[model samples]
Target: MLIQALTPADKSPLLALARRIADAGCNLSESRVSTIGTEVSLMLLASGAWDALAKLETALTKLARDESLRLVHYRTGQRGNSAQLPYLVEVVAADRPGIVARIVEFFAQHEISVEQLNSTRYRAMQTGAEMFQAQFTIGIPADIHIAALRDDFLELCDGMNLDAIMDPVKF
Candidate 1:
């Protein structure tokens, strides 16, 4: 199941929310929380039986209403478990729009899928140049030629004047 919650950027509400999920017998398989400005956003994946899910639904509803938190919850069905190789790709370049889109399109053209991506843009402390950086966790099909892929990726990065690296993701 997938659960998303938005609450005040305080500690108590989140603790209460976690307790509520636990009391309903749901196990949090994966979760991520981030603060955007003054609000805290949470995305969680909980696993359990239907009855426990029902209890969790009730608890979440009450938590949202009583605590003034905004939330959404639903069953997410099955997950993707691929036999593909996992790799981490990192790119850094001068800040510019469409960098992410262009890189994603390049991956799509090669039939690769991105499982997770984190990107940020900031000014370099010393150089004062605006820079963009992205780290992507991608799944490469077992049949793909890793050497060829790396070469092609490097060539593309060279054309874009970006610094990048692609390597296996270690457990």
Candidate 2:
């Protein structure tokens, strides 16, 4: 199940919320939390029975109302075996908007699945230039030729002035 919550930037409330979910008989399988300015958002993947999910819904409703947390939840079905290989993509460039969007667009156009992504903006130590960087775990279908894909991707990256790399995720 996928659960999303927007809550105040405080520790106790989040701990209380976690307790509520545990008390409702749900196990938190995975979770990510990020804070932007004053507010924090959380995404949690939880597993539980149908009845437990219902109970959790009720509890979360009350928690949201009382603590002013915005909570939404839904059960997530498995996507089945992807039959695709995992590749890691990393990109760095002068800070500019749309860099991430363009990369994602390329993957989308190629019908690739993005399993995970992390991106950040920072000042470069060498040149003090604002830099944007992103890392992605992408799923590539079996039929595609990886060498051809790398060639095309590097060409595009060069055109955009982005230092980029794509390699298989090694064990």
TM-score of each: 0.90, 0.87
- Model 2: runs farther than 4 Å from truth? 11-14
Model 2: lowest-lDDT 10 consecutive positions: 8-17
Which residue pairs does candidate 1 place in steric collision?
Answer: none
Worst 10 residues of 1 by lDDT: 8-17
After superposition, which runs of candidate 1 have C-alpha atoms over 4 Å from their true positions? 11-13, 66-68
Clashing pairs counted in every model? 0, 0
lDDT of 1 by residue, 33-93 (tens): 8786688888888888899989988888777775557788888887778779999999999
- Candidate with top TM-score is 1
Residue-level lDDT tens digits of model 2 in 29-88:
888887866888888877889888889888877776754677787788856896899999
RMSD of 1: 1.9
Candidate 2: residue 168 Cα off by (Å)? 2.1
Q: Please name the candidate that would achieve the greatest lDDT relative to the true structure.
A: 1
